[model samples]
Target: MNEQHPPGPAEAPGFWLDTPEHRQWLMSEAERQWTFFAASLRDGPGFFSLDTAGNPLSDDTQELHSTTRLIHAFALGQISGHAGADRIVEHGMAYLRDHHHDAEHGGYLWALRGDAIVDDRKLAYGHVFVLLAGASAKMAGHPDADALITDVSDILDKHYWEEDAGLFADEWNRDWTPFSTYRGMNANMHAVEALLTAYEATGQDVFLSRAGRILEFFTARIAPAENWRLPEHYSQDWEIDRSYAGNPMFRPAGTTPGHSFELGRLLLQFWDLSGRQDRNMPVTARHLIERALKDAWCAHGGLAYTLEFGGKVSASTRFWWPVTEAIGAVAALIKLDRQASDEQWYRKLWTFADTHFIDHIRGGWFPEIDNAGQVTSTIFKGKPDIYHSVQACLFPLTNGLSGHIDDLKHSEPVAMR
Candidate 1:
């Protein structure tokens, strides 16, 4: 609106996926998403959760994941050469360093109320995003990135990484005491993403090796074993805990198709990062992705939230993230195979997202949609952050699994904004 050009769709008849103008449309979409959340800069250091209309919500407690994700998102903006993005990234870096980082405790807090600690538990789920944000910020040349990266990497290695299990432990108390023996696929999945990103930025093989160990446990072992409906909860020994249920919104009892989608994408990235040594990587990724696509996609429109252990729909409520991860997964497939079915599925998913979840008038996507195809926020309040939907638009624009947005300029310049 101000200095930026108005966002507009490409002049195309059919779906944008695999189309000649898709690159341009994707850039436009990225710009729209960035501009929408960039408005959060007005709220200052402790980034406030944004509503669908791009304003700060009434709830002012900023979660650590949200803070790190904003840093990651705005860093992507910086990498892509978005104007005024440095301000956003710098603001986030300052906030993360000042408020969220527990200087004495040696890990980030879970939730903060106006620079005060609310839930101070150090969680791998939140810490991985800290790693991700730091990695992305390092790529963007943020001044504070290296410190954050070193801090989180130390914490993860010392506290969370279990050598026997080859996966991260879920949670710990403030001073690194044992909170629980619980382990989860959700945090490990994101840890893979963060570790891979860290490897990409640092050129460190330890990060790559750690990520591979995790992929071996899940992708090589658990994925095909479970028929690609990846279980969410796990025992301390990394065995599937079929009876465990914690947070319905987070730690659900059944398998999450969204996670399969994420693992599919992350596994492919690991494979590519590993120099494509294992020929089975693509096959495993395809099966996991295709299995999720087949199992969770409703005949009505959007992807279901979670599935029962036997692959029936456990929770039919559609959330924005699964669709975002689905976009990433199918886009990853399109990079290697480019099947017509993948293309069609990609377009179909976008059509559903644009029709239901996207807020054209504002900028952010609605976080949830009910069974009747109406936008609802029963589980999540307002739009959480620009992380998932931003990736849905930006990640697809890159050529390979790495999705280095710094290289986005070399692609076709069709941002008809």
Candidate 2:
């Protein structure tokens, strides 16, 4: 007979993620991931590989979004007193400034292959991450962060922000001559995250105002009108394009349940940041979270990647990022209401993640898993970076979504050692 291991302390009664031991465990796991990525860093102009395990695939192309996320994550590590965190942050910052920056163009390029520009399109999604990285680095006391933040903000305002539409344009050519007619909620959602951080880092009201505008449009108007099933793609005129389907990975067809969960969390964060003035925000957030959970949560385990607007599963495959976002969504609801149902959903999501996504031997999450709870990499392979998983661990441990994790004063002392 096999000997059984006792349930861990995290499974104990009332031992939510905010508990001291759990928070410490999250910090330790974050450090583990940081170390893994740090060891894989490619020097010479400073960039990171796409995957961390087994020969490091996609070592030639460096994605600007991934680079910025790594910078932001490592900056958090730096603030937490991790030893090599600052070095990684510095390396990523140098890469962003020297390599990713388009000298002839106003904005950063999409990706780089060695010294050559590969995908030079200017994307709102990538640009928002640039803002986020700069803000996080600034919070972590990086020397060049202020200048980076200023430059990225200027660029966003000049190219991405649509003053007339009160939203952001999706993409543009390298020279900013040809702008895509496509408008997307994904990029705008990330823009909300970046703008919130920018406001926190600089205390600028303009950033906050812009963030509020995006939130109001999506949460207050669009989500409510659509029965909380937010559309992902839109035309240049901001009309929903039901027929538009781009990349299966990034621009999947149909409504993304993951985005609903993410937008729910961001709405709550924005509401909290705005002094809780918007009474409708918490209500809207709850609806979005519940809609996704009802429609996307796989009957067997995990969540479906995409769903039809009427709550039918579009993509039956499960990915790690959606589950992480669902964890965050329920965590935010728990913070807002402390309802027993919210707590139950939170525990359920964590259980799903631990069972399917977590790689017990490898020390990081698997990026994708099938509905049967078996590991699969049809879309994403080899633990693409720790940004989503680390944040899934960190966000629940915090009191509110204000500023960067480094700047917030946790209710329990963060185990930084």
Candidate 3:
């Protein structure tokens, strides 16, 4: 079904997220999540575990991705002047330096169970987040920020980057000897995000150049060729892998509409950061956002998890992340075009989120929901992390996309409670 907004009154001069009421609400919500996550911290190694109801679960293995994400989130908290945020950021940084990093292997191991390597593979997905965490930490004035950023950047350049391909390889063994031939847009998409943050943090030309190349490959070339239903899996040579489905949660089969929304917003950020030279960037971003909404929005309400390349729904399950990404995508589009339909989408998506995904009493978003908008645990359970939802609240309030949250100048003040 085609989703379009009916003609309505012109939206006010500024974005909704910049308004005092929304800013206050977003900050309050972010603080609530921060308090929830801060409660899960374990002291010895300073790592968090999988959590349910603001408490860590029985899983002892600390995931690199979630740990890095929490660090990044807390770093944002530091930027906002939230009390106790620095301690959380420092705790996460210590975990990354002392626990996650492989000094001999030259990159981070994927997961750890109490100093024993649970999964030692070096994944591009995990490493990109390391870059992001470093950037955020640096922005928040962490003492070891420069070292973390430099180490991750050098490691990425040395191990993962294919200088000729302008894209990253997927994974490698712990000692960095054997490499996986598999390639993926998911990793590269996140690489662009990290690269942009790196460039902003260090003012490096190479990071920006690499980001542009990746955007050109995925947003300019492949996405348009595939009619904006981006293919996720790829071969070593970057050929589409239609039948390969590796992990149900991370590397699922078919196109992820959530990713399309995320790429849409990232492309716009790149366009602005690159001085708006590439006219196709915003155009491609709009196409991606519109196509994702049209193809993936479940008739019952929220977005479906996955869709075939031909625009058919492959997984009808609705998850919280996609909707949050959609909110950011539409917000970016609204800033560019200020179309009434986009504004309608922005408001509509937040309404859907508040009605379904948010946990009013528990204080965090439900990670997964069914098509009927009922909470579900089929794919994820109990608020794994707060990265996506917090960003959805934060990004729209920024004055520009040049840097991390710490670099963003608040467009409006938080309303007095």
Candidate 4:
């Protein structure tokens, strides 16, 4: 007689994804997010941040991440065959190419106020998103995709990449002067994401090789020594910078578990793309993912913002992006293998999101809420981002655990999501 394993959630009788009700609900949420964000384009080809009432805020300053994220979001809409996705893609691409692109400096500018350049720093954090927008638009079949991809790829190779360190340098002044000796894992984490997306788009081994180097540096080498809670800051010599702290929201003092979740998911994607070459990788990814969930998941049914390097809660405030990123990470684990714990965490995080984060009327997630479940915004305000929450809903619907969303439109379609 064969020993039996208990049924995971996906293996249960009514746990089918192809069911009309399930598919419709998932796709509808994804579409709702897309439709809600389309309002940002009301001012034509520039950026518009939205307030809680779904009204565009007074700020006209556009950051590279914000613009590129919108282009990436709508590119997913086009990838999923959502109607009118092309309009937003075209709009965002035009703004990105025209205003954000530095004609004098060659790399994208850091920020813009209307047509004027404000803060022309060439940051790797921002440039990776440009590459992401390019890869996403390329996958979506946008006309300007190739040009964006080629330009950004060349910039990254020429300016950002460090061959000996096997990682990208952080920032530079407008005319390519050295801005700082600072290095960061946040930007490099997202670099893996954009590089993987580029590899998927162009089948370029160079992208894959560079992404692997970053992964190996952080995950395979650094993470194990740090007890799987990756550090956020680093010196020019790549030493851990525990004393460094800037931007409470972005570059917090201690390690960020949210980034661990993201890096874990990216590792899985890297493993998949490499045809599962290394047997040790999945274990490494799992350590990163589960360690984050264990360290950050609070009693309030949400995750804390950041944790100390020793696994203590450094910042107690909860934010929306961490939960969304964790959801994406868990969704990937479930896709890779429907392990019982992964399935349970998947359901648990979605429950928390539905209970606290999502705004049923407005269609996008509320940025933050207190432990009592009352809406709060001490740090984050408005519904400015369409990238994180939307992908949390969209990733589970895809067959592959990687960032690719084309599966929703092609390859053994379950529903036209």
Candidate 5:
């Protein structure tokens, strides 16, 4: 949900106590889950969503967005030394080549059926993910990497960019005229991420320029005033429509927690790189994150998918990917030696896992957790959907594995040691 709601103190018994036995157990569980998810990648272009029976969600339409998510997972796999990142990307390249791509339109379609493009509408959300896949293929030194990237970049620059206002539109017609009213934080954030990676691949000034323009758009147009501290979601012209604010798809009441955490991390990175002063952006982003964290965490350790203003917070029982990004943002803040409360945020992760997503009773972590921290869904688990597992697993593990805790180890050895 909003990620602001800290789980109520009324958590399930024995959550996030950090006992050595529990730490070892959870670490092992994490590794096992990674292995299981990695092995699920099949002969074709996609990975299946696993359920309790170990059956892959075979329907092609189910996970059209896995392209980006898989790339993210592969990156995480690389970071964690899973040795399967290459295989995962290979499967993705095959899928893109075999099924998902629409050669005529110069972008990817959503579904595949034995070498034929199944759904050709071209989701803007999916396009951002394809950028990730294209880049991942490049990093893996796949044969089609350069060609894939150039094609995706052309589509993005041609269709997604708003040359008049210097920002990308969320969706478009065949000629790329803007169509969707749901201007989204998710879309823009992914675009920013994709463009940065694309720039890394090709070092094209044009790609970097687009990325910078997005940062500037957020800074000037979407950023809230000092007192309000909320992200603006709207057209490139910057209107305040309800459609852009409080989307209900991810969260029932539609509070934007992920965006807040993402913006905090992105702004921190931008500030470090540019040294340009924005007196209020950082403060506002931090406030949004803290607020989201407090609101999104459930009574137990599991997280609510999103926060809604009109009703009780809506949460899923299955765990989702934003949890890791949220944790990563907090860890980055901690690394920056900034004054943000890392312990509080970090505790939220452990607490949610312990109470909800960890599946201490079953095996492997659940893909989602409901309000009470019980497994609600397994829609995104299994195989190697890019962003889902890698972001979720690696972000928390890396913070631990990276020796970021060295300072605590030395100073607070009595407890942490």
Candidate 6:
């Protein structure tokens, strides 16, 4: 008798619903999402986080709450032709000028109270978004773009850089002491991205150098150890942080495919910068992406949100942001290696569009999904977050519009020697 093999977990079905029909559906859906987002934008400083039922989440200092949402609104408004975007940016500019800037502390506060500062400490993620918001404001031709960038850059440079580690400090105390014990690949990755955007917007050599240094940081310190594909969290001295002091308690069961996929695209940028120096950059990127697709992705539908450092499998799925980044990364790869590209990558991207990120039933991309791929959970699902929308719109549009994958467009690389 012949032995039969079961479907290995590695070959498990993935959730992707991409098709020509789905593309049409996504475009239409994008339009609808834009309308919903535009309607949420406020003319004043305050904003609200709406639940699935469309009720405002809170009312206290709601205007100051507008900063996060405004970033997403500005990006979506541009893509969807929503008029509220103008007001959103306008309000954001005024808020940045009037409230966010901390002259005494030398960085923007995470939040502001009425004529007082709230959450005076700064988060790496929030500051990156502020940088992104500044870039978006510039794109929108807002007058405050220059000042916003300058102010945010001042904050970033003064407080975030860990000179010995040659990377960023994730969070700062009120006096701007780098206080976070655990440093994250995610935060550093986005800081590079934000700095790149700022460099693009301002053509400032300082920003470009900072971005390049971050790229080097990822290559040198962020990627995982042998047999590992995910990035490691570290301390200021670059020590692996198993203590969970500053890291999240719930580690994924395997390498995070979405993050790996995003890293692949980021590698392409670095590769482009290293052109003529090494042709293997793209090759290495291609292999990493293949690993992500093979081990980290699920076949039934939706990209897996988290992966264990040791490549162990997990049941978690249904985050929309990773899907968005996966799509953008693969799209970018397609543009870069069109000749050597496989059609399946494009199909994989489309598949995600159909299954996890798309709200085929109730509309808009659902925020959270459980392990079994069912959309039943809504306790933290489908909440309107400012960060997700901005990333969703910007990553897609950036890859969609460029159609080119060359990094020669970036500034000169920093000299690390």
Q: Show model 1 residue runs off by greater than 4 Å.
A: 1-18, 42-44, 409-417
Clashes of each: 0, 0, 0, 0, 38, 22
For model 1, how does the per-residue alpha-carbon lDDT over 77-192 read when each residue is reduced to its tens digit? Answer: 87787877888888888888888888897888999888678999999999999999999999989878898899989999999999888889999999888899898999999999
lDDT tens string, model 2, 174-257?
Answer: 999766799999999999988888888888999899999998888888888888999899988899898989999889888998
- Residue 294 CA error for candidate 1 (Å)? 0.6
Q: What stretches of model 5 exceed 4 Å from their correct place?
A: 1-30, 113-118, 173-182, 200-202, 219-221, 226-236, 243-253, 273-284, 299-302, 308-319, 338-340, 359-364, 378-386, 396-417
* Native-referenced Cα lDDT, model 1: 0.84
* Best of the two (1, 5) by TM-score: 1
lDDT of 3: 0.82
In candidate 2, the residue pairs with backbone N, CA or C atoms under 3 Å apart (3 or more residues apart, or in different chains) clash, namely none
- Backbone clashes counted, model 1: 0
Cα deviation in Å at residue 146, candidate 4?
0.9
Q: For residues 202-279, what per-residue lDDT tens digits would candidate 6 score against the true structure?
A: 667676567667766655344534342655466567666654422232233234667677667776765554342657
For model 5, residues 1-417, the per-residue Cα lDDT tens digits are 112222224333333223344334334544455555665476654666665445565564434566556655564454344556668767767777656766565667766555555655655677877786676556546678788788777787777767876766676654444456556556766676676656555656676566667766664455544222234356456554444434344323344565566666665554543343665655654665676677665555544555444324644333455576676667555545545256566666655554545433323455655545445544443432335433443333333312211211132111111
Model 6 alpha-carbon miss at residue 68, Å: 4.2
Q: Rank candidates by lDDT, best first.
A: 4, 1, 3, 2, 6, 5
Per-model TM values vs. the true structure: 0.94, 0.93, 0.93, 0.94, 0.75, 0.78
Best by lDDT: 4
Q: In terms of TM-score, how similar is model 6 to the real structure?
A: 0.78
For residues 1-417, write the lDDT of model 3, one tens digit per residue.
212222122354556655665556666666666767777578777565545577777677788998899899888888877678888899889989998999886889899887788899999999999999998888889999999999999999998999898999889999887677999999999999888888877888998899889988988889889998899999989999999897887999989999999888888888888899878778899999999999998877899888988999998888889999998888788767878788778877887887788776667788887656678798665678789988887777665554546444332323212
Q: In model 3, where do residues sit more than 4 Å from their true spots?
A: 1-15, 404-417
Worst 10 residues of 1 by lDDT: 1-10
CA lDDT, candidate 3, residue 15:
60
